[model samples]
Every structure is written in C-alpha cells, then in structure tokens.
Target: MVSQVVWAQVRSKAGRLVERPVRELRGERLEEYEAVWQPPRYQGRRAIATWWRPADRARHVGCAHLGALGAAVSLEADRDVVAFASWPMRLHWADDAGGYVPDFFVRLADGRVRLLVCRPAGGSPQRWEAAAELLEAAGKQADWQVHVHEGTADPVVFSNLQRLSRWRHTRLADADTARVLRKVFAEPQPLAVGVRESGLPELPTVAKAHHLIWTRKLLIDWSSPYMPHRSLVWAPEGVV
Candidate 1:
C-alpha cells in the first residue's frame, strides 16, 4: 500500500502563509520558509522563551525553552551547520488529522536540510515517539533529515559549551592571535601555555583562544571538563 504524502504549512518572513505538499517543498520555496518562519510565543508558566544570536547567523534564533536553547548552542558550535531557524514550519498528514511544529530547521555546510526536535532531559521520550515518527515521515518526503535531541548526556560537556558560547562572538576573533595560538598548539599543549605563547595581552589572548576553540580552529577534548590552565588544546586536522 502507498503511504499518504505529508503536507507542510509555512509562514514567510513577510508573514504570508503557504501550504504545499512536502515533496514539492524545495529550492527557493524552502529557502523562503527557513528565512522567515518565526516560532510562536511561549505562554506557559514553566519554560520561558529565549533568543540566541549565533555568530554565523545575522538574526537571533528564538528558542521556546532551555532545551531548545542548548540545542542552539550546540548548533552554533558545530562547524558543519551553516545556518538554522526555529519552528520554521508545521507538518501534517494528507488528511490533516494531526500536525507538528519542529524545534529547529538546519542548513548544513553540504547543502542538506535537517529538522530537529528538542526534548529536555527528564522528559518522557515515549510521549514524543509517535510525533517524531510522523515528523520523520514528513521529513523523508521533503528530503530533509530529522532528529530528536534529548539534551546533552555529559553535564561537563554542556557546561563547557555554555562557557565557550560566551566567547562565540566574532568581536573576540583576532587573525594574528589565532595564527599564533594555532602555531603554539601545533602539538598538544596546555590551554595556559598556548595563550601565553600568543605573546599578546594576557586577558584578550585568553578570550581569543576560547573563541578559536569554540570555532573549532583550536580543538579540545570535549569529553574532558574544560580548565583554564590544564586542559589540552591542539590544532585541528589540516591545520599546520
């Protein structure tokens, strides 16, 4: 038996409503949907709506809750994620029996689109399984990837990402300092040593190093807790 095709309802940046079959969603039309779809405001008492501005994107991405915010943080730090938006569209079955709004729509460096759903830690996964399956089916029709983020498993990694995110702004980047730091860590070295070796002002150099790490120009063991003086830092592959 042939499964029913899914439908997508999207709002343009100019506030226009568009509805179409998921298979027909591509090219310019898909770009329009990703560029302008805004997430509905959160009204519940528990989770607060928030906004996050990533260095890679010009506009702030709205997040419905902290778990979504965390997912955004991880996306910002990902080198492959070229762009993303929140709640970019709604999906429904052919008969419109039910619908879902995904947490994020991501554009990868290789030109792939992804739909992400965030379920915070401690939330029951079973509750979202059915909806996720539906979203997955819709995504498959649209040739987009689908995933559900269940919060970070490692508190230390989450804490590290949160700390590094503070330095994610482009203002902290310095080409000369980055070059020097990358050279200093061509081999594995302590975070303090590389920063000191940059031969720049101590405070500014430290911030730049953290920024480079956040951008993945300088690599660190994400599984390890970040430390100012002790954590090992190194250049990524292909960096001399």
Candidate 2:
C-alpha cells in the first residue's frame, strides 16, 4: 500500500495538497506550506543600485536610497563583508507602531549579522535613542547585532566614489592597453602618464583606469579627494 507520506508529496496547481486517500489520513484538509512573502509595496525615495550585494549575490537593481552614508557602507561591505542586504526584510517593532526596515543587513566575515541604520549627524538624540532601544529589543528577539550610523559622509570621497563607480560596469580595455598601463605602474607613477601612454582616447583610458582601481589591480590614496590626472598609482608587487 502506498503510504500517506507519498501521497502528501503531490501538490495541485493552486498549492493545495492532492489528497490520494490513505489509511493515516482519510478526511484531513490538505494545505500546502505558505509561499515566500513578496512585499506588496515599498517605501523610500527609490534609486537604482550601482553595486551588487555580497551575501545574496543579487545583481544591481532598484533599492532604498544609499545617499552619502549608505554609499560609504556599501563600499566597506564589498571589501570586508561576507554578505549584506539593503533593507531586505522587515522587523516588527511593536503592536501599535508599524514594522521597522533597517537600512542594511550585513553578515561580516566574522559571522555576525548586523542591522544598520543611517541618519543625519545632527539628528535628535531622543528619537535615535528610542530607535536604539527598539532595535535592542528587536535584536534580543532575533539574535542579531543592531547598529546606527549617524553622520554625513565625506563629500570629496563620496563624490569620487560616485564618479569611479560609473566605470564599474565597463569592460576592460585591450591586452596591449592593459600591458602598457601595467608597465607604466611597474614603478609608482602619476596615473596621467599611464593614461597617455595607453594611446587610447582619454575617456576610455580613464574608464579603464577606473575599472583597474575598482578591481584592486591598482592602488591609490583613497583617503583623500581623488584626482584622475595627478593621483599616484602602483600595481601590486610582481604584478605584470
């Protein structure tokens, strides 16, 4: 005789269980497990992502505004983070108040899931403290770390990142172009010379340089305001 377990595996089009009569369950209501929830609506001033999520491997698309603060977090997460989500899930805060959706959910290389929110540097303490307390309660319930980032990002650095990220989706230039750039950077040099020596048009050359910098094939002072012409760049040791 076919067991009830075998019969339970058959599901109908509407996600209802196809009940093949079995001894263990004669008239039991066959209900399928619920499907994954898709949010019916989203909140926030919508913006498209320039970067990918490390955790879910989801390619770029629309998401909540990263602005200055969120932009800073995105770059760091790409480097040190194991994975992250931008407002991926909702956490219910209380019965009366609506659910809170964190700005980011990061899983660090150290295996911690951190919930992060960004606000203005001069935001109200009382409101933020209340938020922190609510997040603390939420953390206790879900066993995750909750953090708040309250500040404006450095204007120069942030602007430079915005410019550089434009080349992130660009394809690498030719082999000869890459070779010339590498040879120029065989010693630390102003990126301008490398761009000129590539013999490519300045636009494409600069774009290639941007890609190289983004992929870590080249290094420069990311600490300060970045200038394409005068920025010093060096290839990793032994990099041809």
Candidate 3:
C-alpha cells in the first residue's frame, strides 16, 4: 500500500503535491464580469480614495495576518466573493470597464474563490452601504463569498450588519505594517472614553476598521509562496 505518511509529508511541501494545473488572471475572462451584466460605477481606486496614502500598509498587514492564520485568504476590499489579485484588494464593479485594472485575483489550491473589499476609515458610509446591498443581491445568484475589512486605524462600522449572521469582532496584535499604517488609518476624533478607561494606547489611523457585509473571511492559500505568479491559477493574465 502507498504510505500515507510519505504522501502527506510530500503534499505538505510546496511543488510536491500532484494536482491540477493552476491558471492565471490576465484579461477579461473572469468567472464573471460586471460589464456583461451591470453598468459599472467608480471614479478612482477605492483603497487610495478610502485609506488614501496608508492603503498599502493597511493591506500588507491585513494580508500578513491572514497568512499567519493559515487560511486561503486573498486581498480585496470590494466586489463580490471573488478574490482580489493584489496587496490592497479593492473591489470594483464597473459598468464600462474604463478604470484601473483590478489589483489582484487569487485562486487557492483547494478551488475556493472569494472577493476582497478594502474599506478605509471615514469614507462615505453611503457608498459602502450601497455596495453591501449589491453584494447581498449578487451573492444569492452567484454563489460567492464576500469578505470586508477596515484598515487598522479605521473604525469597523456596524450600521448595516443586521442581516449578517455569526458576526463577531476580534482584534489581532499589531505588526510592523500596522505600525506604518498608523498615520493613514488613524481617526481624527478622540478615542472613546471607554477605550481610554481600558488603558489601551491612543488609537492610530491603523486602529480603525469596518466589516464588509460578508459571510466569512476572504482567503488565499500561501503554502507555496515561492511559486511564480504565473504558476497559480486565475492570475490577471489568465482572467481574459
């Protein structure tokens, strides 16, 4: 009989598992596209607009936490459950496809797909709410999962989460990236009296966060970080 231990050990290492070939995202051939169905809407990159200068640090730290958790989490702060392909995953649904290319799209080894939506602290709550509504409607039809997160310094808005289930708030230890993002994600308002009473440090911009109306955490499997971007399935180049 084949030794299960050997097989398991081999699979644990990158480039050792015998599996299906991975595809990359390149063009317009995503599993789904907004232009084909709905009119696009957007004026700028959501991350830069939302978190502004600190967006990259916010995303890097978030992805690092996700990586440490050993889940298949990709980065995206917008769109449906489809994975964002990049560091600061901002979701976009364009009616005409006349904006920046998507940040990144991820395809895990297990074949699960999700979209990432990054929301900055102190953005137009209206837009976030509108996007949440669209995601809820689209989720039922597309059978996708959506994950939303706020930059560390931003407040996690809880206004429209009544419809979601199993929601809980948890905080992770701040990392280097979180430290760098402090200036951008930090809020201008004073810390709540309660927060001060608890003896925590004054909140930084990286301290604020909001939950996107999503079912579960967005994921990207990074067991094999050394693998070339082209080796992965669902790369940007492969999308079209």
Clashes of each: 0, 0, 65
Candidate 1 segments whose C-alpha is farther than 4 A from its true place: 28-44, 120-130, 186-189, 236-240
Candidate 3: list runs displaced more than 4 Å: 1-104, 152-240
> What is the full ranking by TM-score, best candidate first?
1, 2, 3
lDDT of 2 by residue, 122-233 (tens): 5688766655666666555445677666543566655666556656543554566666678778887788877777677887777787778776778777777778777788
Best candidate, lDDT = 1
lDDT of the candidates, in the order given: 0.79, 0.54, 0.28
Model 2 misplaced stretches (Cα beyond 4 Å): 1-73, 109-111, 120-125, 170-180, 199-203
Ranking of models by lDDT: 1, 2, 3
- Model 1 clashing residue pairs (backbone): none
1-240 in candidate 3: lDDT tens per residue?
111111000121232323111121222223222211111346853432111111222232222232211121212232333332333222223331221122223443445554344443466897667556554433333343455544323222221222121122233323442333233223322223323432445443113211211222211122322111221211111111
TM-score of 1: 0.83
Total colliding residue pairs, candidate 3: 65
